[model samples]
Target: MLLVIGPGAVGTVLAGYLSAAGRSVRLLCPESALPALSAADEIVIDRVTGGPPLRAPKPLLTTTVNPERVTQIFICVKQPDLESVCDLIPPALPPSVPLVSMLNAPSAVHRLRERFPQHTALPASVLFNAQLLEPFRARVTTVPRIQLPFEHRQVVESFAGTGIRPVRAFGEASAWGKLLLNLSNAIAAVTHSTFRDILSNPLLRASYADLLDEAIRVLRAARIPFRAPLPVSLSAYQMMMRHAGALPWWLARWKWRLAEGAYPSMVSDIAHGRPTEADALNGEIVRVAARAGVDAPLNAKMVTLVEQVGAQRPPRYLSPAELRSALGHHLQT
Candidate 1:
């Protein structure tokens, strides 16, 4: 049996996928989600790319883990909740249960490994966007795929004939590659802009470019192998950024294909008054930059902005220009 912890966007969508593929799955959610989870007989997945809604038979939901039946565990909580999730694992499951980290933080894999030194914690990346529109309903904007490090071929075979795609990564390189695209999530959270709007605005794109460039510099200085998350190469992405007008067209029509209606996870987190994964996203860059003796001013500023917004009861959405000016003001300080 597969135990998927957390009923948020990532957990719910993945539970749907596995259950639809005929796997025996269970969802372990917080007490807050019990009412919604109990009410829904099935999980509704609204595909944004023009497909009939997918209704998967909802799996059993509980607040506690049954270590006896759970053969494998997937930690799908937001970054802020990760440490708590880590603490929940050791006593609940046997040390050998294969654990997969699906959170967006590039450093999450390492953190999980450190936390559970005895377990086989595999690093994986989710290259899709899922939003929890309701307690039991989710909107998935991208076709879901899991990228696993090459060392986990046995785990890869577990998904055989399940329609779930798993790509073998080149070590930690895949996580860093995915981080390039995730840098924009903080932007969306702060600006309340859809993916299209963020890409379309010249100033916003410039800010995003700075964030990406800063991450690349930190990665280079740290001697970490990095790849472009988009279909194009890093060089091609740099070339595209040089021409602002071309950037949005590429993002909307080719690269991202993210629907205008899609909201990033952090955006939804702030909207729901849940803690945002600012540390996992921009804060990771700031940490790496600090260790490398490099200044990631844009990411640093974003980290501050996201933390401040996350603390609000009703998070105020900053305008794109406002976010841009804030970052600019910090750079000048």
Candidate 2:
């Protein structure tokens, strides 16, 4: 059985997909989330295949159950909620039941591994960008793709056909690769733009490239092997920025059309007055850079901007130029 904790966009996406795949998936959420979810039977994914909308019936299990019955538990909560969520997992869960965390940062894996020493703790990174449109409806801007670098092959295999395929990362190298990609979330969020937006803008694109470079440096300093995929790679991304003017007009327009529906998680946090994973996303970069004796001014500035915006007395939008100015020192250099 799959127990998906925190019925937010990520959790809902997994629940909807797995349930549609005929898996015994159960959604465990707080009382507050029930009202928004109780009345809906479908999750709308606008990013994957236009807007036909994906539906998952009331397969949601609201009541708490014995943890032992939960063979696999997917912790889909935000980074800040990790400790609190971990506390909620009953100790009675069988020692063999593996706990998979779909958190973005590298720190979450180490922390969860320490907290759930009795159970098999695996760190799984999700690649899709999901947004909750309403209580029960969510739009998946990206396909549901995930890579888990845990040592347990069997545990990863169990989720093979459930729309969340786990990729094996023999050691810490794979985890680092996931972390490198996650750095883009903050850039996309701070700009109040989609991934395509950030990638399209020459300045924003350069900012992203520099951020990844900083991340790569930090990983190398820590002796962690970090590799990025094509398009997202440091060199390839820089080339894209340099040749920004050469893209076909039609291709650029199509990219924007696709990104128009994409909603960033940090932007959602700001809109809803909820604390975001700034600490995990950008703050993680700062922490690691400091440890490695390197300065990650771009990420550090983004962390500050996100926190300040999130805490403002009267919420206001931080313009792209203003945000770019904030990171001027790093960018100008």
Candidate 3:
């Protein structure tokens, strides 16, 4: 049995897919909100690519649980709530029950590994983007994809039949690869635009490239082997940034198609006046760079701007000129 904790976008989408695929799934949500979703399926996934939508059968929702019944558990809560959620789960769970973390921040993996040493823990990175639009309804802007960086290949293989294809990562290198892609999430959230829009804007594109370049430098300094896959190579991306204005229309469209959709989780949070995972995404880069004695002014400034935006302060939109001014001499070539 698969246990999906937290009924947010990530958890609901996973539950809907797995349950629709004939897997027994249970949703564990907070008690206060349980009654509101008692009769609901708890998950509705609308595939953006015109694929058939998936709706989970009536979910088994409960606040408390006997973890022994859960053969596998997916932690889907936000980074800030991870520790509290983990603490709520009964300690009776068997030592063998694998706990997979589908979070954007890589630091959560390390924290969970340390806190739950007795249980088999697998640190996973989710590749898909989804949004919870309404009660039990999840708009899946991208297909469900996950990359698991763990030593147990069989554990990942076990998920093959469940539609959640798990890519096996040989080592921590895969973790860094996932983190590299996450750079765009914070960028999209701050700009309040789609991936297409974010990439289309030359200035925004450069800012994103600066963030990724700094991230790569930090990873390299930490002795982590992280590299982007073919066609999407880090070097190629940087080169594209240099000639973004010169790229042919068709070619640029092709590239956007390959890139993931604008991050819906961030969009939903921003629209609803909730705090975003900026600290987990770009802020994490700033924190790591500080420890490595590396400079990441672009990422730092972006983080500051995002935090300010999330605070509901004035100047909601930063114009290109404003962004240039904020970036200062860095924009001067």
Candidate 4:
């Protein structure tokens, strides 16, 4: 049996896919998530790129974990929820079950491993774009694929017919690659902009490009392997960064299609009055850079912006220009 924790877009959508693949799955969520979840035994899976909608039905639902019955576990909660969930997770899983995490940052797996030393923890980079339209309804706003830690053929084959594709990776390279792309997550949240808007705007694009570049520098200085999981290569990515404000036509067009119907997770967190993962995403870059004796002023500035905005009772609003000015001051300092 497959066990999924959390009821966010990723977890909710994953449970539907596993059920569609003929796997016995149980989704464990909090009491607040039950009303909408129990409304129906099936979830609507809409394919935005190009496909008909399908229903994944009858996934077992529960609020508690049954360790013995669970064969595998997938952790799909946001980073801010990690600490609170950590204590409740370790005791519920047997040592033999492989724990797959779809968190944004690679360092999250290390924390999970420390908490659940008896189990095998693997970091899976989520490449799909999904949005929650309603309490129980979620849809794939873009393509769906996941980069797993290693080439486990059986694991890869299990998702063969399903729409969600799985790719095998090595040495945590995929996680770092995904992290580079996700540097914009906080930017999207902070500016209250859509994904396309974030990339299309010169200021937002330039800010994100610099943040990604800083992360790459830190990783290189730390002697960590960095790879681009996207179709682009390392040199090509660096070249693209150079012309950050003026993006290639093809890339910009491709991004809009995927981003049109989606919003960043942190944005959703802001909307629902939940804590955002600013610290885990951009903050992770700052932490890693400090350890490598490098200063990432751009990312450090973003972390502060997110914290300030997130603390406001009514989410603090900041224009892109204001954000750029804030970043500029840090760069000058």
**Which numbered prediction scores highest in lDDT against the true structure?**
1
Q: On a 0 to 1 TM-score scale, where does candidate 3 land against the true structure?
A: 0.88
Instruction: Give the alpha-carbon lDDT of every model.
Output: 0.79, 0.70, 0.70, 0.77
* Tens-digit lDDT track of model 2 for 194-297: 66666666666667667777777777786676655333455665566556543422243353233444656887787667888877877877788788887777
Write the number of the candidate with greater lDDT, choosing between 3 and 4: 4
Stretch of 10 with least lDDT, candidate 2: 248-257
Give the range where candidate 4 is weakest over 10 consecutive residues by summed lDDT: 248-257
Q: Model 3 over residues 111-202: C-alpha lDDT tens digits?
A: 87788889877767776677776657887765466777546764575566766667656455666677776676666666676766556677
Model 1 RMSD, rounded to 1 decimal: 2.2
RMSD of 2: 3.1
Model 3 lDDT on a 0 to 1 scale: 0.70
Candidate 1, residues 42-138, lDDT tens digits: the string is: 9888876666877889998877778889888888988878787877774657887888888887677788888878888876888778888787689
Q: Whose TM-score is higher: candidate 1's or candidate 2's?
A: 1
For every candidate structure, what is the RMSD over all alpha carbons to the true structure, in angstroms?
A: 2.2, 3.1, 3.0, 2.2
Residue pairs with clashing backbones, model 1: none
The Cα error of candidate 1 at residue 101, in Å, is 0.3
* TM-score for candidate 2: 0.87
Ranking by lDDT: 1, 4, 2, 3
